[model samples]
Target: MTIPYGYAKGTVISAPSLKPTRRDHETQYHLHFSVQVADEVWDVAVNVGTNDSDDLLKYKLVFDYRHPLIQTLQASPAGKNDLTDVNALPALDFVRSDLLGTTGRWRDSAVMDGSDTPEPVASLTRLIEKALSEKFDVYVFGRFYSEGNGIHDAHMNQGSKGRYIHRPNSDQNDHNAVWQDGAVLIDCRQPEWAAYFAAFEQQYLPTDDLGNPTPSSSPIS
Candidate 1:
């Protein structure tokens, strides 16, 4: 998604190889890489800072998935952007194809849920790790949304915000003992396709036949 501010655009080029990790008795894809945007390579300096490596990788992957070029590359015959001009459902299919490749056919797939499902997570993680290792750079822009938002929200809701109890530098605590640090929240409650939403709000959503903003209970989500 484009941010409110203008940011440099970059390409997310992948390496020719993949890396695998064993977790929960399954193997997955991890891609290793840097990010290139506006002639600058982000998060590539050795020992840059805490969370820098992770942040760079995540940013690259997310933008890569959202890139229009990549979307065009993956568009299917029934799901191309042109089809959207005549059919809204076809447009939705195009969006789905953009996010999930041709191979991702199952509706409500485990990977889409952002859960610890073996196949999806493993596949993604391995792709990411491998990309990182191969040093393929993806062009990315904008700062990643901070982790504090979820934590603050959880605290406000009076939910148990969980503890960071794993002792650092202790042999008793393996890497798995540490808490996973990031959360991916997909906020599609409103029309998140900014351009499309703007057009719909101005023209179609408000009218019966002629142009008007009439009150209706129709859900945009």
Candidate 2:
């Protein structure tokens, strides 16, 4: 769990949208991108939410409009992702698990703001910023900030033990540069792509061989 599930392509140089944050105990929706890979320019972020809103319980967004990062973004060439590291895609905990093929859309963060709250994380942050304004293709994990690098634990890793951001503990404060957070979002455009994932009512569906989340303290349901 050293955070590193790569797959890149660039654009949106410094972010200007994607909001809906709470910070201190979670409720995310971050943004930031500067990807470029093969010529270096890494610095990404695309966090979705869950943590505040009472740990955002009662969920179900296992989407996958044809996952596999959308068949690798309809077979490459939009922002970039010809498989560049993270052991060649598929398994950085495979985007919130159940191995793609998801479909349970019914979300309910206890009526986040009532009024028939159908925000669905602001409708998937407007389809992940309409697939980041274009030239899409991005399925990152976390860590590796060679000066503000991005791609955070988008969501769910399992049985959090307290670290701060959605899950991470071990005395945090960068507990030797955190790891095993969670995330599984993809934003493509060719014929469609979107798999924004989220998980936190404090995770833990068994993990350990480096996938972290093997401990717990209960009370987060």
Candidate 3:
């Protein structure tokens, strides 16, 4: 609940591409891309899986996301946005904001693979490509790097426990916050919005006001 760094907002200038990072002899999982905010191009990393494990239950993604929040995000300013209160703006809160909707719209990466449906990476890439071709306004949300022009954590930011909170060396609990969730939104500006959402199997819904898990919370099935 103590996210020291503020939220991330960017304007897509290039199509998203895959570029994996290596860490400690293991491949860090993510989809890399570039976004333009003003005159600078910032890197964007969206997690595709947990570590190197390709387990389908470990992740969830929604390709054609629809919500009332899309209208607000479509008109938001681009770039790294530092704000005093996220709840007052177009910020996201997966549980609180009902971004996932109630029709079980969230798709599991593994389930998609098993059912011959496009997986998270493929689905996201298709959206970005379409966004670029259609000249749609794209917005990416996450946390910006302190010394670099990039953003990561384009996924759910609450309901983590044990080692799933984050890296081992960091204060795991500090990364969770309400109304500051990470997401990627594509604004067609024609009353159509495509959104990409992700979450680990370990994350649960119904987070508290501080983004902590509640007693009645449950994982997305």
Candidate ranking (lDDT, best to worst): 3, 2, 1
Q: Give lDDT tens digits, candidate 1, residues 163-205.
A: 3122334443111110111111111212221110000101112
Put the candidates in TM-score order, highest first. Answer: 3, 2, 1
In order, candidate lDDTs are 0.23, 0.46, 0.63
Give the TM-score of each candidate: 0.25, 0.29, 0.76
Which of 1 and 2 is the better model by TM-score? Answer: 2
The stretch of ten residues in a row with the least summed lDDT in candidate 2 is 170-179
lDDT of 2 by residue, 1-221 (tens): 13333444444433334445566755555544455554556666554444466655434443335655456434655433322224334433533444434555435554343222244555555555555567455555444443444445445444455453333433332321222333444555445545555555655445544344545434334
- Using alpha carbons, what is the TM-score of model 3? 0.76
TM-score top scorer? 3
Q: Residue 190 error for model 1, in Å?
A: 38
The true-versus-predicted C-alpha distance at residue 38 of model 1, in Å, is 4.7
For each of the candidates, give the backbone clash count.
Answer: 25, 14, 1
What lDDT tens digits, residue by residue, belong to model 3 across residues 103-167? 35556653332121336767777777777677666677776665678878777777865444434
**Model 3 worst lDDT window (10 residues):** 109-118
lDDT of 3 at 103: 31
